[model samples]
Target: MKTTAPRDQSRFAPDTASNGSVSPKNLLIAVDDSNATTRALQYVGRLLRETPNVSITLFHVLNPMPRELMEHGGSENPDMEHQLGEQLRKDQQEWMHMEETLEYPILERALERLRDTGFPTDRVTLKLGYAGDVVDTILDEVRSGGYGTLVVTRHGPPGAARLFSSSIADRLSRDLSGIALWVIE
Candidate 1:
C-alpha cells in the first residue's frame, strides 16, 4: 500500500518540525489489566510527564459477549418470546453497565499512575472501545486518531500461550509503518 512520509516522532520525546508543529506528539497507549501494561504506562509517564506540550491517549478495548450468546432463544409460553426480547434488552444494558463498572477502575488506576508522574489530566485522554481483536482495535484507533506514536507492552512468556495467537507487539511491528511504535518491556 502507498504511504505518506513518516512522522517518526518518538512517543517519549516528541519531535518538532520546522514550522513548530509537533509531529506525533499525540501518543496512543494501549492499556490492559496487566503489570506489563502498567509498566509501559509508568515508563511513558517518567519520560513525558514533564513535557507540557504532549498529549496522551489511554486506549482500551473491552471484549463483549458473542453474538450467539446475545441472541434470544426460543421460549415455551406464547408471550415468552416478547418477554425474552425484553429480557435481552435488559441483559444487554446490564452487560454494558457492568463493563463500564469494571473498565472505569482500570482506566482510573492508569490515570492515577500518570497523574502521580505529574502528567496533567487536561492533556490526557481516556478512550474505551468494544471489539473482538485488541491489536486491530488499537491500530484502528491509531490510524483514525492520526497518532504519531503508538505505545504497547510486550507481554511476557512469548511462547506456548501465544503459539496460536500472535502477540500485540509482534502484529503491530509487522503491520505498522510510517509511525513510531514503542514496545515497552
Candidate 2:
C-alpha cells in the first residue's frame, strides 16, 4: 500500500515563455494585506511591464500555527489526552479552512492584480507557507528559491510605532547579505 502526501497549496502560474531557458531576472515578492504590500506589488507591476524576461514569485506566509493546534504527545492520563486530541483535531480543520478561504484569496487577488498590469502569467508563481519568524522565513525562501531580488513592503502606518511595530523588513534587510533587498514604501 502507498500513501500520498497532501496536495500542495501553491498555484504556479502557467509559464507562457516560448523558450525553455530560465530568465536571468528572478524576483521574490512577499505579500500581505497591508498597504505596503499593495505598494510593493504595484511597483513590481510597473517594473515588469517595461522590463522583459523577468520571473517573479508571489510569496505569502500564513500566520504561525495557533497554540490550540499544537499536539501534546505525552499525557499522564489517557482520557484527558483523548479529549485534548479531539480538540486539536477540530482546530486543525479550522486551520485548513482558513488556509483555503482566507489565505488563498489574498494570493489569488495579488496574482490577478499583477496579471491585470500585463505581466506574463507563466513568469509568476505563488507560494503560501507557514511563517515562524517573518524574517527568518523570508531568508530561507530567498536562499532556496535562488531569487536575485527579494521584494517586500515596509508595512504599518507612518509613526513611531512604524519604527517599532512587528514589521520585519528592517530585520530582513539587516540579515540579508549578497541578496538584493527591495523594501517598498
Candidate 2 structure quality by residue, lDDT tens digits, 1-185: 01111236333432422443222377888877666776778778877766876888877776777775677575789998898888888888788666646777677778877877778776777776565566777787776666678888775556533421345777887888877888877
Q: On residues 1-185, what C-alpha lDDT tens digit does candidate 1 reach at each position?
A: 11111121123232346564436788888877677777788889889988877888777676655685478887888799888888888887777667766776666777887777777777777767566677777777776676779888777344424311336688899998877999887
Question: TM-score for each prediction?
Answer: 0.72, 0.73
Ten-residue region with minimum lDDT total, candidate 2: 1-10
How big is the positional error of residue 88 in model 1, measured in Å on the Cα after superposition? 3.6
Each model's backbone clash number: 0, 2
| Candidates' C-alpha lDDT | 0.69, 0.68
Displacement of the residue 47 alpha carbon in candidate 1, Å? 1.1
Off by over 4 Å in 1: 1-23, 73-89, 156-166
Question: In TM-score terms, which candidate is top?
Answer: 2
Model 1 sits at a Cα RMSD from the real structure of 9.2
In terms of lDDT, which candidate is strongest?
Answer: 1
